[model samples]
Target: MGLNYQLVLWNNHKKTYDKLIVLGMLLYIILFAVVTLVFNSETSIETLVIRAFGSLAIIMLHIILVIGPLARLNSAFLPILYNRRHLGVSMFIAAFIHGGFSMFQFHALGDVNPIYSIFISNMDYGSLTDFPFQVLGFLALLILFVMASTSHDFFLGNLSAKTWKRLHMMVYAAYALIIAHVFLGAFQQETSPFTIGILVFGFILVSSLHLITAFKEGHIDTAKTEEKEGWLKVCDISEIEEDRAKIFTVEKERIAIFKYDGKLSAIHNVCKHQGGPLGEGKIIDGCITCPWHGYQYLPANGQSPPPFTEKVATYELKLDGKTVYINPKAFEEGTEVNPCKI
Candidate 1:
């Protein structure tokens, strides 16, 4: 939201979120270590630290992945989406600890370099059960490091929002590598039913949530809209919920038709910040608030409030009986259009 970037634009909510995250992480690590010691007193402290941090990192990554789809499925999860970057950065820190200690314990002091030993020490690539799974973890950690390093607004501004988003999308690839690392590494060594069940359950839950959300959005994207003259029929006025939007694809671009306060306005669906799905957001204080970051815009003009110059293209909307219609052509950014009464 600025030309020059500071470290962080912290608010009371962000501070409270961060403190809760730190406290929860500390409590989880302590409790995990204590439980491990109680059951297996002979286990080394190094192993305990490695296992504790590794499990914590995996759990955090799962939470981070689920947050997006969960938020899409229900607006109640949007608060978690607001601070997701913090969760990702915290997950990376835990992973870094796990990777560092693992390399030290398993590969250090060898004649070859520890980093080199990670790849060469176990070259059983042809065998799934005996693969050098540490290499998978190393690569995943590298991706996580890059993503975490660039999670700030400074990088987003310098890299351009599209490029930044594509780079961060590598998180899915990193998640896959991490799954392979755990399956071919830990699960192979520890063939306990409890461990396998937990891994299977996590994989199924994360995959199912993403699939469900994708299917729901896919239906919306493929919806057919009838065009008459120059106006496109988006939906019935009754179909749009109050304070929410009905999104439609028109002329290769997405349009968000929001019904609010007994009136309707149309704007481009993409948010100026982060290209978030603005149509999925609900109107608050008479402005369309972007779901990802809470960027707001007046629906009539597709412009932010004064002192904030961000704007999106607006569309001319009309009503015929119970049907809602929008002109397929878009107005220039920030152009004002009268809201059609509901």
Candidate 2:
């Protein structure tokens, strides 16, 4: 596995904020160079500045769309998913640049109306092959704009997760349009076989990543299937070895019971990341660590500290005389239910 450089660095929230500001400063410099110097000097030339930005925007869109699924397939990609909305907003801003520049360069000027020029004599529409190529970019930008506008957690908190996911799924529709835009707008105009090969090759690479993810998660439904609640418990305080955890199978469910020092901590063995067995993972620095991607959980409370807020169903453990008893009820975060007595 590849080492995560960012994780190894000193983690300070304020420093992260400062880094973002630095990145924004650098981005402004590049955008200024392109919009003012590069395009302004060649406004009258045929270098296709607007179309080039459109291609750039579409490529960024592919990265934004793929990050979430990629993170599921490989937890190492989690950082991208953590800051995904920022990427979406960046992609929308790039698309806005492409769209605005195209509008002015090809649609405005002269004594004729801007509206008439936009729809009719945009020069791109003159060719039979590229007549509707620009429209694909326009429609895709609109979709991206919508998604970017609603990407905040405020929208996610107000709308149900199902509704939010449905709205965001439009990103895929935008992706398809962007592919069409690239094929017709850039490849057609450039007339270079190398460009076509590059575009097609990029598409295959993104699709292959997604296909690999699907294959890895093909048994996800089976993992979630309910287990028959016949035999599960395999312990008591005296039964479990000190500083170790035991796994028990219940209604298709796997649970972990840990005895640390004098306190007993019971938790779901399934890792929240991808159902990796938590019982098999090692305890590090007072936290139970998932062997897969090092996700940690405090078994006594069933709540993760920083960087791992994800949770799984937890059981309530009780000491009846010496035999430990467990309750099956599990609830959402912030619920009033108390975990097993530590």
Candidate 3:
């Protein structure tokens, strides 16, 4: 939420979040190194460092993937979702360290380039046990690097929210590749069944959470309303909580009818910042605040406050006794639609 972009808008919240991330990462790496040394005194420092960072990256990625669905399931997790990009960039750093050391340790002394050697040196793709899994890891790292490089709002603004979101959605692909890399490469060499089982559990957890959240939200997309006099009947006024919203899908567009300050106003459910579900958010300081990033907009006009240029489409709302109805058509972005009195 800024009129102009600098490197970072370091507020107290961001500063605190980043500090926690750094401390957590450092603590994990140190604990990993210490535990590995205590258990396996024969393990070389190089191998230990690579494994520590690689494990950290894997854990960070799991956390990153889980945060979205967790937030969807419960609003208490929204605080964690606020600064996820910082965690993403930090995860990339750990992954880069792991990949860099791995490349050097395994292929640097070869006659050809290390990256080239990763492919040519491991041509046993035909063998499942001896497949070239490093290639998968390298590809995943490349995708992460791309995402990390463009994590800033400058790129988000330039690329447009939709395009930026699509680009970042490549994290799922990267996750799949990393899973293959771990199972085919590291797990093949490891003897511990418990370690492999933990990875399986993580995969199941992430997948199950996403599936559950999606299934829960699926009804909202498929929801249909009765039309009366060119207005779609949304729901009983009692269904909408004060300072909250009830989202309705109209003509393939999701409209959020907010109940605040003893009146009802309808606006596009999609937040301009990152396409977050505004319907999931609450009215804060008389503005509809996005749950994802706290981008605020006036409930009456669907416009961000002064000095902010973001806007969302406003829809007409009407009240018939205790029932709420909304016009199927939407006004232009930033159009002021008078709120329906309760």
All candidates: TM-score: 0.91, 0.59, 0.95
RMSD of each: 2.2, 8.8, 1.6
Query: Which TM-score value belongs to model 3?
Result: 0.95
Report the lDDT tens digits of candidate 3 across residue range 220-304: 8898678898988999999999999998888778888999889999999999888899999899999999999999999999999
Q: Across residues 1-342, which tens digit of lDDT does each residue of candidate 1 receive?
A: 544577777899899999988998999899998898899889999999899999899988988999989999998898888899999999999999999999999999989999999999998999988999999999999999999999998888788777889999999999999999999999888889987888788889899999999999888888987889978888889899999998898766888899999999999998877788999988999999998898899999999887777899999999999999888889999999999997
Q: Model 3 scores what on Cα lDDT?
A: 0.93
Q: Give the runs in model 3 whose Cα sits over 4 Å from its true position.
A: none
Highest lDDT model number: 3
Which pairs clash in model 3?
none
Compose the digit string of candidate 2's lDDT tens values, residues 1-342: 111213323347435744674475356546755675654665443234465556567666767667866776666766556566666787687678788887677667857775455555556656767566767777888898888987765565356445777788898898888888777766766688886887787788778888887776554323322222522234556777766676655455667777775666667787655445677566677777775546777766666765545565566666656665555554453233344444
Better by lDDT, candidate 2 or 1: 1
lDDT per prediction?
0.91, 0.64, 0.93
lDDT of residue 304 for candidate 2: 71
Best by TM-score: 3
lDDT of 2: 0.64
Candidate 1: list runs displaced more than 4 Å: 1-4, 261-263, 335-338
Model 1 weakest 10-residue run by lDDT: 1-10
